[model samples]
Target: MEDLFYFKLFLAFTVGSTMVTLATVAAERLGSRIGGLIGGIPSAVAISLFFIGYTETPQLASEATSTIPLTMGLNGLFLVIYVGLARWGAWIAMAGALFFWVALAFLVILLNFNNFLFSLLFFILSLAGSYLILEKGYHLPSTEKILMPYTPLQILSRAFFSGSIISGAVYLSRVGGPIWGGIMAPFPTIYISTLIIMAKSKGVEFSRRITKPLLVSGMVNVVVYSTAVRYFYVLFGLALGTVLALGISAASTYGIYWFLKKRMS
Candidate 1:
C-alpha cells in the first residue's frame, strides 16, 4: 500500500513536470498557439484516470469522468479570469483564477452535476463564450516565436507547480468517489503552471495571446479524453484503454491545431 502510494506520486510528478517543461519550451520556440495546444493535451488527466481505474475499479473511473466536461468548462473560465487579470500582476491573476476555479468547482460537487449531456452543454457554452471574449473582446493576437534561452530554474519551477497540483488531485480523487475523482482529474494544473511560467518570463501580453488557444485546445482535449475514458476504460481495461483514449486525444488535438494554424495564417 505504501509502495503503491509512492508510485502514484512518482508517476504524477514525472508526467506533470515533463509535460509542463516541454510545453513551456515549445511555447517559447514555436509560438504560443502551438505551445498552448501542446500544453493543453491530455497528460495529467490521463495519468489520473488510469490510476483511478487501477486503484479502484474501471466503472468507478468511467463514472468519475462524467463531471470532466463541466469541470473543463470551469477551466475555460479559469483562463478567462487569468487573462483578464493578468495585466494587474501575477499574484492577482493567479489568486483570482484560483478563487473562481475553487468556488465554481465545488459548486459542481455541491449540485451533484452528474448528467453527461448537461455537462456537455455547459462545456459547449464555455467553449463558445471563452473564444468570443478572448478573440473578439480582448482582440488578442497569435504570438510569433519569442526566442529565449532555457534555464534549469525555469524548468524546475514549472515542473514543481504542475507536479504538486496533479499529485494533490490524484490523492484527493481516492477519497471523493467517482464524481470527485472526475472533477479532480481535469483540474487545471497544467494551465496554472503554464500561465505562471509564461507570465513571468514572457510578460502579460504574451500570456494573453496564449489564452485563447489554450482554451480552445485544453477544453477540447478534456472533453474528448473524458468521453473516451467513460466508454473505453471498461471495455478495454486500463492499459489498453488508456492507450486508445490517448490516441483519440492525439488525433483530435492535431485536428484542432491544424484548424487553428489555418486560422492564424
Candidate 2:
C-alpha cells in the first residue's frame, strides 16, 4: 500500500509536468514573454534539489527509517559534506540519489537488501524520471539564460543556495537516511522555485521567498543534527557508513540522470 502511494505520487508529478509543458506550449504560441519564460529552464539549482527532496522525503518520514535514526543522522551528515563543495548544482542534487543507487548495487553484491524488491523499485523510479525529461525540454531563452555569466547577482545566488541545500540535505539524511534525509534535502529549493515563478509573473522581487525557505529548511536540519548528536551513543554504527551513504546517493542519481539524458537525446 505504501509503495502504491509512492507510485501515485510519482504519477501525480508526472501528470503535473505534462500539464505544465502543455501550458508552456500554449504560452509559446500566444507569443507572450511571460509565457515564453514559463517554458524556460528552471534554475539548475531547482531541478537538482527537487530530485533530492523527492527521494529523501519518504525515508525521513517513515517508520522503517525510525529504526535507524542515528544511522540516518551520521549517514546524512557524511554525505552532505562530500557534496557541499561540488562545483555544480546538478552534482549536489544528484548526490544522494547517486549514493542510494551505488550503495544498493553493492548491497546486492553482499546480499543485504532483497534483490528482487530493490530492482523493481529502482526500475520504476528510473522510468518515471526518464519519462519526465524526455517529455519536456526546458528550452531556456538564449538571451536571458546566456546572461547568467554576466549577472553577478545570479551567480552568487546560485552558488550559495546550491551549496546550502546540499550541505543541509547531507546532514539531515544522517539522521533520517534515504527516507527522512533524502526527502528533507530539497524542500527549500522546491519552495524557492515555485515562488520565483509566481512572483516573476506578478513582478515581485522580494528575496524573502528564497531566503525564508533556506532558513526554515536549515533549521529543520539543525534540529536533526542536535537530535542525532544527543542519541549518537545509540546509533551502534555501520562499519563504512559514509562510503556506503555516498555510494547509495551517487548510484541512484547517476542511473536516473543517465536514463533521462539518453531518453531525451
Candidate 3:
C-alpha cells in the first residue's frame, strides 16, 4: 500500500510537471491571451485531485474536491491583486499578493462551512464578483506580439517549480483534512512562476495582460471540473471520473475563452 502511494505521488509529479511545462511553452509561443487560456486549463489541479481520490477514500476525495472551486475563486483575487499592482514591479506585487492569499486562505479555512452546496454558492458568487471587480475599469491592452525564448534550463526550472507545488499539495491533502487540502490545491503555482518568467523576459505589462484572461478562464475551468470530479469520482471511479471531468472542464474553458475574446475585442 505504501509503495503504491509513492508510485502515484511520483506519477503526479512527473505528469503535472510535463503539463505545466507544455502550458508555459504554449503561453510563450502563442501570446498572452492564448497563453492565459492554456494556463487556465487546471492541469495541476486535475492531477492533484486524481491522486487524492486514488490514495484516499472516495468520500474524502469528494469532500476535498468541493473546496477546489472556492479556492480557485480566491486565486482569481490573487491575480487581480498582482496585476492591479504590477506597476509596483513583479517582486513587490507578487509578495503582496502572496501575503493576501495566505491570510484569505486561513480566513476561509476558519469559516469551515464544509458543505458542498455552500461551497458551490460561494464559488459562484466569488468568481463573478472577482471578475466584475477586475474588469470594471481595466482596459485590455492593444494586441502586442512578442516571443520570449527559454533555454533548456529555464524550461526545466518552470516544470520543476510547478511539479513541486503539485506534489506539496498532494502531501498536504494527506496531512491536512479535506478543507485544508482543497484550500491548498489551487495555490497559483503555475501562475506565479509563469508570470515571473514573463515579467523578466517580456516585461510586466505583457505579463499583466495575461492575468485577466487567466483569471476568467481559470475560474470557469476549475469550478466545472471540480464539481464534476466531486460527483463523478463517487458515481464512477477515479479514472473515468477524471476523464469525464477534464472533458467538461476543457469545453467550459474553451467556451469561456471564446466569450472573453469576443467581449474584449
Candidate 4:
C-alpha cells in the first residue's frame, strides 16, 4: 500500500511537472515564470496535501503544506517581473535554449565526469547564484551575455549537482546497515553551506520570506528521514525522503525567487 502510494505520487508529479514545463515552452511570451507557476500549482497543491496528511507533528505539518507553495509563490513573482517584457516568438528562443541544454545534459551524462565536474561546478555556480543576489552595481551586460555565456556553465552545473547527489546515493548503498545514516550524511554539510551562502548574499529577502522556508523545511525532513532509518529501521523511507528533500530544496530555490518578487512589487 505504501509502495503504491509512492508510485501514484510519482506519476502525478511527472505529469504535473511536465505540463508546467510545456506551458513554459508554449507561451513563454505570456511570461514564463508566471506560466510556470500556473503550470506547477497543481503539483504543488497535491504534494502539499500529501505531506500535510502524514505529518505527525502539527508544526511540521504546517511547514510541509507550505513548502512547495512558498516556492511557487516566490518564483511566480520573480517571473512576473523578469519575464514581463517577453515578446512574441519567445517560443523560438525557448526552443533554442532547450535544444542547447538537452545536448549539454547528454554530454555530461555520457562522459562520466568527476570532481572537476561536481566540486568545481558547485564552487562556480554557487558564485553565479551568489551573483544574482550580490553585486548590485554589476548588472548582466545584456541578454546575450547572460544567456549565451552561461551555456557551458549550465551544463557543468547540472552535471555537478547530479553527480554529487548520485555520489550521496551510492554512499548510502554502501553503508547498507541503516538508511538514516546515509540520509544525514549530506544535509548538515550542504545545509550549513547553503545557509552561509544564502545568509551572506544580498538583495534577497529570504530572511523575511517565511512561506516556504525551504532550507528549514528540508532540513527537518532530513532529520525525519534519518530518524525513520535510525530508530524505526525504515531504510527505504529514509532514502526516499532524502531524494525528495533534494528535489524540494533545489526546485524550491527557484520558487523562492518569485515569492520575493511578489512582495517587492
Best by lDDT: 1
RMSD in order of candidates: 2.7, 18.5, 2.7, 15.3
TM-score of each: 0.87, 0.27, 0.87, 0.29
Tell me how far the alpha carbon of residue 114 in candidate 2 is from the true structure, in angstroms, after superposition.
22
lDDT for model 3? 0.78
**Quality of model 1 by C-alpha lDDT:** 0.79
Cα lDDT of model 1 by residue, 91-190, tens digit: 7988999999999988888987799989999999999999888888888887544354557786787678767766666666677678887778788876
Estimate candidate 3's RMSD in Å: 2.7
Q: What digit string (tens of lDDT, one per residue) describes model 3 on residues 12-87?
A: 7888899888987897788767775675688877877877777776667778876777677678788888977888
lDDT (CA) for every model shown? 0.79, 0.34, 0.78, 0.31
lDDT ranking of the models:
1, 3, 2, 4
Better of 2 and 3 by TM-score: 3
Off by over 4 Å in 4: 1-88, 114-120, 123-236, 239-265
83: Cα error in model 1, Å: 2.3
Better of 2 and 4 by lDDT: 2
Task: At residue 85, give the lDDT of candidate 4.
Answer: 22
Q: Please, what are the lDDT tens digits per residue for candidate 4 over residues 33-95? A: 554333232222223222322322223322222122222222222222222222323333233
